[model samples]
Target: MVGRKPERKSAPPTDVRAHVLASATRLFAARGFDGTSLQAIADEVGVAKPSVLHHFPSKEALRASVLDNMLAHWSEALPRLLLAATAGEGRFDALVGELISFFAADTDRAKLLVREAMDRPDEVRLLLTAQVRPWQTAISEYIRKGQRHDEHFADVDAEAYVLHVINLVIAGLAVFDTFRVLLPDASVAESRARYVTEIIRIAKSSLFAGPALSAEPRDPSLEGAPNRRNGTTR
Candidate 1:
């Protein structure tokens, strides 16, 4: 009897690094990098300052990791985006829908990006030039192809158009919570639906030609395209 002891169960290992990054991202998005502190992040994660430092080493390193995480998400999605761009019909819907989802899935992402741009313009500029510019160029070339085929507007400045759409999405989502108040009659969910719908409509209407604007059905090939909203192929 006294020799018998109950076995103790071990708790699952915590992913402290991930928790720290998540807290840092949320805090940085809500309050600018200058306003957020490592101690605050530690508190949010319910860990000691040393635990945060054990993972990130410094506030600057944490900030860079947050940006890197966002960029990693985009990099993973780049292939799908490129495919949608060159896939011809329904390309606008596919491309724009994915873009919206990328940020709208977590508005924090948009806020973080906007804050980064304002807080460290030079750094953001370098990141854009080095990482985003190539994707922009590739997509621009696809737009040019569409123009050549008379599928898109000949006068559309492909580079500028892409850039503006990106800005519209990021900036729109960043402030959407505040902006939704204008639609007083609608619930938050309804307002968001309308907001996203209008963005897609405006983007499509401005970029496409005859058939796309008219009541013509979407291409059969794209009928089976993945539902970007839910991440499922139809």
Candidate 2:
């Protein structure tokens, strides 16, 4: 059991690149992109800087690659989650739940994501376009599609709603580090579910109510909220 020979194992180029990206995601989250050096990323991945640079030309490039990968992962996972996310489970809550779950599940990735979204705003527009929509325009547009057939509230503005949802999701993650200090005992799952449930209640009452629910005493919990068609969160 003493001489383990380092548990020798190897992977293909794609796998290696993924490994580098995952390592960089964690390091960059802890240390900013500028703070995290190529050498440091390479060291964490147990590879040479030259090897890292061979796969990715620069540190920023590597970070961007990780972001891009995550975006792709979300694009694929969203629909499945929306479908499986039941009404009993709280569709509105589920949207919030999923976003928080995503970031909470990947602390380093979440940190890297929020930093890039806020800091490198200029570089992202086109990169995000190609990565998420490509030929589809933008994620905001895709989100708007739900409103056409009353999947969501018809009165709600699509762009506004999309931005609101995106914010609710990412904001949970953005505050994770700070919240860590406050809710140290709360698991990522708990914080996300609670926050998402709160956000959905706010959105449904204020964002979608159109003065109806406002006239009445809104339930603090979304348990009594009405359901929408198409499995969409009302």
Candidate 3:
């Protein structure tokens, strides 16, 4: 006797949502938030954009969902590193190292972050608000703790220090990768490795009344992380 036909299983709803967000991440990284159309995103995923809308109501929602998921992943992955830095385990230097590992692992998502900071629409601003705000707060408190423990400089300004370190990392990544066409000879891996190391060292350095360290040269990956801060504020 012939066997009965097997039934096909439907794709899980969770899987469908995951695919949509992954597609959105790639498109948003290459095409700016505004540049990326829902239709284009649908085409990338081989589903109707409306199918994407079923999971995420709008493009803004999609971007936000993708970003939130990325943030959640970092939170889950970095518990040990977080404890080391916040609990005064002398791994303050390693907190920024976490950022480097994250960047190297998913360059596009990291690029999307730089892009969000550069041209953030009102909705995308939440991404920075979520990441930068907590980082500034945590770094400030941690540095203050280090100062009390004599681990950091006595007179180091935590706010200024955090901002400077962020600028160094964000701007470092931007300039290296942004202008690659013009500086085609630069190596992103070699240069970014050095820049990340230097930035962490800078964060860990003492704040003597002496002169500051000279600004580091732009690395290949950082070419993309541009700053238009030439006598003009954003």
Measured against the true structure, the TM-scores of the candidates, in listed sequence, are 0.81, 0.63, 0.66
State the C-alpha lDDT per candidate: 0.80, 0.62, 0.64
- Give the number of the best model, judged by lDDT: 1
> Would you give me the overall lDDT of model 3?
0.64
RMSD of each: 7.6, 7.7, 10.3
- Candidate 1, residues 136-217, lDDT tens digits: the string is 8988997899899997889999999988888889999999988988866448876787778677767777887767544665
Off by over 4 Å in 3: 1-14, 86-90, 118-135, 148-151, 179-187, 206-234
Error of 2 at 227 (Å): 14
Residue 173 error for model 1, in Å?
0.8
Q: Give the runs in model 1 whose Cα sits over 4 Å from its true position.
A: 1-13, 86-88, 211-234
Which lDDT value does model 3 have at 113?
71
Backbone collisions counted per model: 0, 0, 18
Q: Per-residue lDDT of 115-220 in model 2, one digit per residue for the tens?
A: 8877788766665565534323443454456456444566766556655666665766667667655554358555544555555566555444333653653344
In model 2, the runs with Cα more than 4 Å from the true position are: 1-15, 81-91, 127-158, 184-193, 208-234
